[model samples]
Target: MKKKLLVFTGSPRRDSNSAILAVEAARAARKAGASVEVINLSRLRVNPCRACDRCRDRGPGQCVQKDDMKKIYPRLQQAEAIILAHPVYWFTINAQTKLFIDRWYAFGADEYRCFKDKKVGLILTYADQDVFSSGGVNALRAYQDIFSYLGAEISGMVYATSAGPGQVKKNKTALKEAYNLGRELVS
Candidate 1:
């Protein structure tokens, strides 16, 4: 059977640093024999969750929202690995990414179990290169907590720290890390 990866990018602009790395990672995963699907959040019309918990009531792991995510939900269920590619904002994930995560609960209580043992990877871009910055490590930790709650195994976190969108391309160390992270999906 062919393996598959679902990559989600929360960057609001096209070809942002995070999106660039995400595309590269997807390409690497494809070369590694995994089919890839990339979701650009900017193109979606999803909204934040209203804390309705309708998914729990559905008793079958279905999101109540009837928008664009309805289509992606099934893809997410079938993915062997999920990748969150995003840029840092306010020392954490952008509001768009966080909103997506929050709505994930609409699937089902046990629906989250599908993530069990499945691999997850994170690609983060930020303006601060300082590892100790409130935005750097904290963002990773926050995501770790969220993914863990859903039983997803975070295999790796690839972060690009620089001042500009394309600056990551020139950062050999970060690029190597991103490639290695992509390689992990196959291993």
Candidate 2:
């Protein structure tokens, strides 16, 4: 069966380089025979986590806040492979993306467990090689720490370094890496 890969973009810019790069990766995965879907958090009306803790009491799928997150929960639960494509913001994930990650608490109870044995990847775009502002290798590390607690394995990550607006489209090397990641997702 073709693997179901879902790419969630956290950048506020709907068509940001990171988002486009994710699309490219998904396209590559499709060509390699894997089913792919991309969700742009910036465009969706995902609400912030309410911290109601009802999910903990209810067992599974119990967020009380009625919003776009309801749509995200199911997809994340069902995806065989997931990709978090985001731009580096102050050495961390963008605001909306970070909120989504924090809201993942609804999926875990005792010790952080959800979609066991599933594969996860991080895709980041930076504006410079400063290793700080634009992001260096630490971007992947931040994602690893969170996913590790969630029981997801890091299959691979694609990074576009020293990239600016429209830079990703010209970054052939990064694009190829994205394509390779897509192929690997299904392989």
Candidate 3:
């Protein structure tokens, strides 16, 4: 069976550097024979978790909110692999990405069983010279902890410093890394 990979783009800006890399990765994943879907979180109306603990009462992957995330839940649960591509803002993951991830709390009702053994990939684009200066490390660290807690394997990460939109196109190394990450996740 073909591996199903879900790619989430967290940039609010259109054609953002991170989104560009995500597209590149998705293209490569498809070429590698994996079934891939790329969802733009900024285009969705995903609300923040209410901390109501209602999902725990209901069951795994259940949320109280009636929003677009209702559609994402099934895809997220069924995917064999997932890729999160975003830009670091305020020294951490952007609000869009954070909000989407926070909603994953619903999966916690089942101890994140849906994530066990799942392959994960990360692509981060920042405006500084390096990860440390851009605070991209903070986001990476958070993902490390988040996926580790969920028993998901982080297959790869590609981070680049692109000061403006489309600048990441000049970063061949990062682009190559993103392509490799996609292929690796499904392989």
Q: Pick the candidate with the highest lDDT.
A: 3
Task: Say what the RMSD of model 1 is.
Answer: 1.5
Compared with the true structure, model 2 gives a TM-score of 0.90
Please report, as a residue range, the 10-residue window in candidate 1 with the lowest summed lDDT: 57-66
Rank all candidate structures by their TM-score, best first, as comma-separated numbers: 3, 1, 2
Give the better candidate number (1 or 3) by lDDT. 3
In model 1, which regions exceed 4 Å deviation? none
Listing every candidate in turn, what is its Cα RMSD in Å to the true structure after a full C-alpha superposition?
A: 1.5, 1.9, 0.7
Q: What would the TM-scores of all predictions be?
A: 0.93, 0.90, 0.98
lDDT of each: 0.80, 0.78, 0.94
Clashes of each: 2, 0, 0
Expressed as tens digits, the lDDT of each residue in 6-74 for candidate 3 is 999999896699999999899999999999999999999999999999999998878999999999999
For residue 101, what is the lDDT in candidate 3? 96
Candidate 2, after superposition: displacement of residue 178 in Å?
A: 0.6
Candidate 1 per-residue lDDT, tens place, 1-187, comes to 7788998999997558888788788888888888888899878988777778777877544767678888887888889998898888888888888888877777557757777778998988888757457386887888778877778789988887766667777877877777777778856
